[model samples]
Target: MLFRVNWRVKVPSLYWTLMSFSTSHGAWKWADRLRIRRTTVDDYEGVVSVRSDINRGCDYIPGTYRQLLKHNTGYAGFIDHELVSFMFAAEIDNGCSVVIQSGRIKEEYEGRGIISAMKKHSFHDLSRTATRSVSVTSSPFACDILLQRNARLLCKMERLIFATSRHALKNTQRSPKVDQSSTIPADDAFLKNIFLSSEITSTIFPENRLVIRGTPYELVTSNIERILCLSDQILVSKDYGTGSANLISFGSTWRSNHTDVVFINLFGESVDDKIIFEHVHRHVAGKTSSCEDKIIMYIVCTKQQHEETVKRVLKKHSWELLVVHDLYAIEESYSWMN
Candidate 1:
């Protein structure tokens, strides 16, 4: 699904104390002054303002903020009637889990317990139905805080970012001989079987979790359809030598800050380097519009070797490596009577 672009727009340790603040006078004073509530369309400007203050390059919130607000999943925090923090508990895996996304607090409000308070409110609202909470972060401090909360570390992946223009990518020469037949478009039946296959569940996915566009979904029958719906193109690559599925990849496209963005999630430990490039090529080509348009591509790989392979391929294609991030996936499960 393609989303249109609407251009706009954590310190852990002491955080625990702030989150667990009791009914003491001091805590009450702080709690009474801050207001927490579900976000509405009215909060759009405030959300954009808070995001702008952080100065994070190329944010997707401005474009998808409204879409994310659907299902009443967005939440915000306010002090003196100013929106300081915001978060979204996006439902995934057939509503059996929610992956927290776009959580942010103004730079001035960092470590002031604003985010913790917002999380407390949001999770409380989702507690009855959402049995699992999942999040992906590149910040070591955030990872530490999740670990402190007893969230299991599912797996870490290398986030590879590349910046290139449509012209550069289009002009790049293709590999002399790529086994195009090895990769094929994945249909409903193919995805249902591959995603649930025991071999794929144990080996391709990290810890039985399928991380797509930075959100993790457990590899299960219920999640197969959602996964297929979320991705624009799902490709399965086979090893001709062995005639076995060797890699499965998901690609998605959206507009952010006037530039086209393509996100590719690759699952497999043993994949051909050429095939990896081919998958990326197909996604970018499908979205490329003008020669002058800029494109940013984010690729997530579970294996270090795959990361290296992607780097080599991008370099060969004249794509500039922007920055690589060490991303971690954390999850915590809850038990509740149905």
Candidate 2:
């Protein structure tokens, strides 16, 4: 009903793309309308509705929607005053790069070119200052589309999800003992030193970037504070012989459908360090089980060699492997600015 425009019109920084629609005379018509603009708190309900519709009411979007808006720049598309699509972009690496995420389109409105239009609008808005854009996705369609847009694949990771009750975790295996000296306190100064150390950066992080809670951030001083704020708990294991960090993990928890979801990003020197990996994994699980009853845990392994390590550890703790999928980090560098 919002597509009754009889005359072509244009607005500043916004344009209409005429799509062919069949008419009685088989003539071309422009019946598709998409109005994209910067999203605000007022659009929260609409955003949640579209997200729930797309994900069938099972997702973290509703819980993290406000946080996303508060932390990133968001845009929404509407047709007939009804929100149908949305996306978010966070400026990271001191504005040198932007991470695009939380993109969703209503189920009924798929394949309407809305995603393409939204990408163009969002990128144009960000390209003024950002030199590159990064995104992570598990969808094959999205991968193909990004490749078509000249986006390079930065890295591939395996997303392993373990679902188990706290009771089950406690009953299965004895807690692994961790050396108290190896536990790094969650202090700003201490974390910054470890995160920025050359040893950890070269060996643990993928492409020199830390992907925490599904968002990739460059490991630099400017981002340390921000990263610290985003994580709920950070666990690190130090190699006492060299006094350098060998394993680092971040844990963040959110409630979804009355269940507590714990997401962990684990980085280790190599698969050979399975002992430390298992120790840190047990430590995190022990901490979470103290407060949460129903838990869904997510672990991401960037190195292919470490996938088996992750699975073996989860299995050792009697955790159920609900799903495993490949996650790709893609980047598109802007040549116009360079």
Candidate 3:
């Protein structure tokens, strides 16, 4: 069983005495509350903000992000009344993604070492379960947390694409109804279009149903290491379809959390160029399924095969059609300060 290194030290009496004076000493309040409880949907927004503040690279999905967490083991650390510090870890025993999501300490509360205190609580919660493992992305702070906690770094990818597809419910002048609800299953027909049928995907061209509104395809793969990357994910047609490959390299283990299955690379093989990728994107967008939440798919690929990579991804999740994209290129320029 994995556990935290015992790096305990006596808290200086002066610090505790100083903390006693301030009401915002809410960190301890959170630590106290967590002792007898677990986190829930109610604490999402606060934690989301912390996640956003700490990682400023991407957008967030609050509605469905925490939905699946309820089914598995979840942990939260509330500071200053709201959940200022949070960790969303998934269990190895479960089929869900064991993500050690956003962690943050509020601006005013930074110097207090609140993150470590909150992590202590999180690790304690995780230790109760018999699950063998969990997953977390790479972050300097998170790296420290894992190291201090004594968790193994089983595996990691440099650039993981945490992508999801959302039905752009028009929030304009008129109140139009969303034909589909707010969330969809990861294995629905829509996702299947982008994940289940790649072999026959080349048969279809640009005629498949596709959605092209949000993030542009070129921007998605501009930095991805691929041959000819395009911006797209799911695609569908009369008979065959594709997986989230518009901008993805079919399957590159960037943000792949699937514990049981791994995808094959469709780079430089029996793949078709031309409209194959576009066709799959079209089918993925126009397809309908029972899922209601926003749907999105992530792909990683060889830089040389970016453009036609979608043709390979479509063979899998051809049913669960949704938005598709590749991981953002890791900019070495920005890391110099770190």
Top candidate on lDDT is 1
Lowest summed lDDT across 10 adjacent residues in model 2 is found at 12-21
Please, what is the whole-model Cα lDDT of each candidate in the order they appear?
A: 0.70, 0.65, 0.32
What is the TM-score of candidate 3?
0.39
Residue 252 of model 3 has an lDDT of 13
Candidate 2, residues 201-320, lDDT tens digits: the string is 887774777887657777777777768777777777767788676777777766666666767777867465455455445445554445467677777877766667877766776677
Tens-digit lDDT track for model 1 on 119-161? 5566667656777777776655557766776778988887777
Model 1, poorest ten-residue lDDT window? Answer: 1-10
* Candidate 2 TM-score, true structure as reference: 0.80
RMSD of 2: 9.1
Q: Where does candidate 3 have its weakest 10-residue lDDT segment?
A: 329-338
Overall local distance difference test of candidate 3: 0.32
Name the best candidate (by TM-score): 1
What clash count does candidate 2 reach?
Answer: 0
* Candidate 1 residue spans exceeding 4 A from truth: 1-32, 40-42, 53-56, 70-72, 93-96, 173-177, 333-338
What's the distance in Å from true for residue 155, model 3? 3.8
